[model samples]
Target chain A: MSMTHWQAAFAARIARDEPQWLAPMRAAAMTSFNALGFPTTALEDWNYTSLSSIAEVPFTVGASASSTTVADLTPYMINAEWPTIVLLNGSYSPSLSSLDSIPAGMLVMDLAQATREQPALMQQHFGTVATSEHAMTSMNTGLMQDGVFVHVPKHVESETPIHILHVSDAAAAMSAKFPRTLIVAEAFAKATVLESFVGMADVAYFTNHVAEVVVGEHATITHTKIQRESDLATHVSTTEVHQARNSHYVNFSMAMGSKLSRTNVYTVLDGDGGGVTLNGLYLGKGTQHTDHQTRIEHAQPNCFSRELYKGVLDDASHAVFNGKVYVHPIAQKTDGKQSNHTLLLSPDARIDTKPQLEIFADDVRCTHGATVGRMDEAGLFYMKSRGVPAETARRLLTYAFAADVLETIENETVKQALEQLTLERYAGSGNNTAHAAREH
Target chain B: MLEISNLTATAGEKDILKGINLTVNAGEVHAIMGPNGSGKSTLAQVLAGHPSYEVTGGTVHFEGEDLLELEPEERAHKGVFLAFQYPIEIPGVSNAYFLRSAYNAMRVARGGEEVDPMEFLDVMEEKLKIVEMDDAMLARSVNMGFSGGEKKRNEILQMAVLEPKLAILDETDSGLDIDALRVVAEGVNKLRRPDNAAIVVTHYQRLLNYIIPDFVHVLAGGRIIRSGGKELALELEEKGYDWLLQEALA
Candidate 1:
């Protein structure tokens, strides 16, 4: 479909129900989306990823929330008691959400309802950080109807994490869903936000998600996203963050499923003494293509940033990782480190990794490295010499290749769950496997 | 218990072992001492299947089974072990996990039930004592960040657990101090049985003072040039390999 077709379809189908305050922003977003169009290989930022497959499909927009019971969500829930927000097909489902236990000062509700109740908050942050400068994010901003809106008040220190579960149960093929999420943590507050994008059925669809995070001064926040979409789906998500002074933010992204998936995370340390860590692990098999593009901007002095992204590719799958760390001229005393490592399991698997560092500061410590290689043969032989079968040895090493990233997760329950998922994905099935042999 | 007939192997285009012949019987410790470039480590690695060396011509029989026809792990299951000179470091896999996996694999190969962590821990505790190592080593990644002595001791600990019938020690004493060498030698000694044999390949005879070998052979230019009893090692230690090389040429 062409850009005009998308704009015309959006106006005909979605313009009737929006409030008057959002109409101008939506129109401006539509104009931006039209100007940017869909990113192609011509763009440097998207050199390795192609959107032809997605652009060829005439995906119908405005898919309604699918009807699902609490039982359907059993397999995806990390914890049963944590406050949950469910977004089915692009729209929020109140019946499936359980926010009754949320703290008194915390606000967790659907984005559309939050827009009505907290219009000032929505207008202030909705499209501010994740502006309409990019194509997919711009399109999402133009068409987004419902998503998640979370606000943790000053000094709230929410112990229980908020889970945003995005489920795509498309009634028909070629369905498209646009879900947005806005998280705001006030000063001295602490919170963890987990977003899971899961496709219930094996059907062709498209999911364009946009999330914006605001970490106040002296606050700490952890944001994790686990994407397990359908093998036939196309998933593109962008997360933009702004950090205040002395704030700490950690973002963990794991991409396990989808035919074509592109994940972009852009974080700017806008205040002095702030720190940020972006860690990601992507597993690809079959003909899947997983791409991760991250950019961290040190806009202030004395900021610290660390990033480690690793990919495990098997079969004929392909993975791409491009990490860029920019230190502005005024951002002196910056300490930044970035690394991208890939492990190719099969001979046919391929990975393209690049670590781009741009430092304009005269006094700064910055380092970046990228490595693309196969499993260690010497290590394999050592294991085999100890009586481990070749197949089992390979699995163990592959699992170990991805285990270090899981070690950086602070949430114990989520870390264990993600570890188990990683082990199962790479280790396959066997008696006395790594999962069974785990110590504590 | 083990026999090698006319064994010839090459690493890449360079021949490392040429027309070597040896036999090891049960209850015997044979020491193959040689100078540098004498294929001592190559011979040991070939016996345990290092995969880097290509055996062009050889017939190795371990207890009447074709040892060369099996994979490394199969050879391991058939009671063959190689204590590496430079043990490879495997990160992210705990030492206890690797030990239990190897132990269970050997057990299952022998048609025995696998042991649980509790039972495995008990067995590990005993083996750690054999090597004079503490239990702290078991929680670390396999051989990762271990000192030289710690790595060698970990190898000996594995030897104690696997209990292979034919253990090949490839320069196992090269990087050990006096205390570590004695502990390693004692570990090997305690694991010895009348039904098992060992091939200790070394350049120096310092290690033979602790673990005495029944037979000592001098390997030069990929061939065993001389053979004698335990006293031959002491003579080589005193006289060096030059006199033996001249005698072999004459």
Candidate 2:
């Protein structure tokens, strides 16, 4: 079958028995997806990562069960403090999840259940943040069957983080899992949510996911998305965040997984004094490829946005970071800064970074910078002279290099945990700590 | 405790130290006075096994062991300390953390027990008082954005913590005022024990007034040309190295 046949098949599957309001929206999204097709390197946004692997996957959309359990995916769940909500093959599995101390007025249930019980609220926010412009997001909306829904009432604050663990374990079946997460924080509310993606070992699968977050007026939200999939899997993730007046949002993305992965993070400051921070760290090893395309729009005046993304590329892996900040003509007093830095660990590794600022306002402070280089030899030698093994010395120096970005994380425990994990990965990639100190 | 015989060192084919011979015994303080490029700092770095300097035809013995055969950190673990002229700035590494790591590395080398965090903090607090440094500096990254006097005081603080047997101070008195000079000298004097020795490498007699030395030697062109009592430092300060060089050549 041709590409148009696959698109038609996806649209036909979603049109049957769907809600009347969502049916027309799904058809519109399918038309946009057909027009866009799959983005190629000719497009500046998809320059480094290719979509051939995702396009070639032979699969059908729907929720299906597999034999994999939570015990089999324990190593990927790095954060044990947060209660886990495991999703097997795109459907929520309560038997494999542990939710004990959730706050009052907060909902963590399946998307279908939320739609059935609170149709009005679900209809108001679902598919609102993720528009129909992007093709992958359209594909996700066209094929999504089951996902996680979270809602926090006005003025309620959650003390602990909410974790949604999405695992694709359909090893025997050729399938595509589209896990959707919709989070709405009411006015004056505070919450933190983490989404982690995992897959079965040695499995060939495709995952198209979307997470839409809506922050009400004067609310605060902190979100983290960690994607670590099987080496043979192909994945595409898109996060759409909308902020109201005087609200604050912080989103951190760490992508260190999959054979081919592309993530799009777009934020809109819809009201005045709304602020956002987008920070990311990506690690690409072997022949893996990763790309991140982010957009932050200052629709109203007096809004502030800052973005910093860093990557460490080794072997023949490639990484791309494209960030754009747009300020409306009347959005005066806007402050925006975007910086992307990459550390090339091997001669064959590659990185492409572009920081674009389109400010129509006359009075604004906007700046961007990009840097890509090797490690500092002087810093390495200084550590080695202190009897730290050369391998350990390099590790310590690299840790220091990345510490500037990691230290900005407000939570000390999370910051330290990620630092330790990054160090272990650095060690596993042949840092040679045994002979580091011998040179001194 | 240490002996250097016919030592010659060079940097980039330029001779810095030429045929120098000196002996430092236990319970003694030897002060080497010289002008700029008189090889005072080169001697200390050579003894500490700095990589930039090439030692040609030199025999260094520390407590009857071949000192040149070991690395700089090994020399440090063997009770030899060099107070650097310029302490390096290590960002993201705390002062207390770096000191504890160095202390434990030394302790492990000598088959001694490592100090826990509480014990280490206690020892650090007690030693910090001698150098007049507050606990706030210990909490910060090592030597980052520190003043000249503060950096010098931090070096003395590290010495007090390590408690090395042989200490070499190279130009430690150059960037200090009167008050800082007295505090640094007092800290050094407090670290001195009967079994420990120190080599004060300087170009002026001002430091010797604060910390008295048993012997004062004149080093010119990498070799010691004159040896005298503590009064020799006074003579060199009265008439600069130019007068001494003229007399030695004559």
Which one wins on TM-score?
1
Query: Residue A42: error of model 1 in Å?
Result: 0.5
Error of 2 at A131 (Å): 2.7
Q: Tens digit of lDDT per residue, candidate 1, span B58-84?
A: 799999999999999999999999999
Superposed model 1: Cα runs more than 4 Å off: A13-20, A170-172, A431-440
User: Model 1: which docking level applies?
Assistant: medium
**lDDT for each of the candidates?**
0.90, 0.81
Error of 2 at A249 (Å): 0.8
TM-score for chain B considered on its own, for each of the candidates: 0.99, 0.98
Which candidate has the highest lDDT of all? 1
DockQ of candidate 2, scored on C-alphas against the true complex (2 decimals): 0.18
What is model 1's DockQ versus the real complex? 0.65
Clashes of 1: 0
- Cα lDDT tens digits for candidate 2, A402-422: 555665666555666566656
- RMSD to the hidden true structure, all candidates: 1.6, 4.5
lDDT of 1: 0.90
Off by over 4 Å in 2: A1-12, A59-64, A70-83, A169-175, A199-204, A314-317, A341-350, A371-378, A381-385, A426-440, B1-69, B113-115, B174-178, B201-206, B214-232, B235-250
Clashing pairs in 2: A389-A436, A389-A437, A390-A436, A390-A437, A391-A433
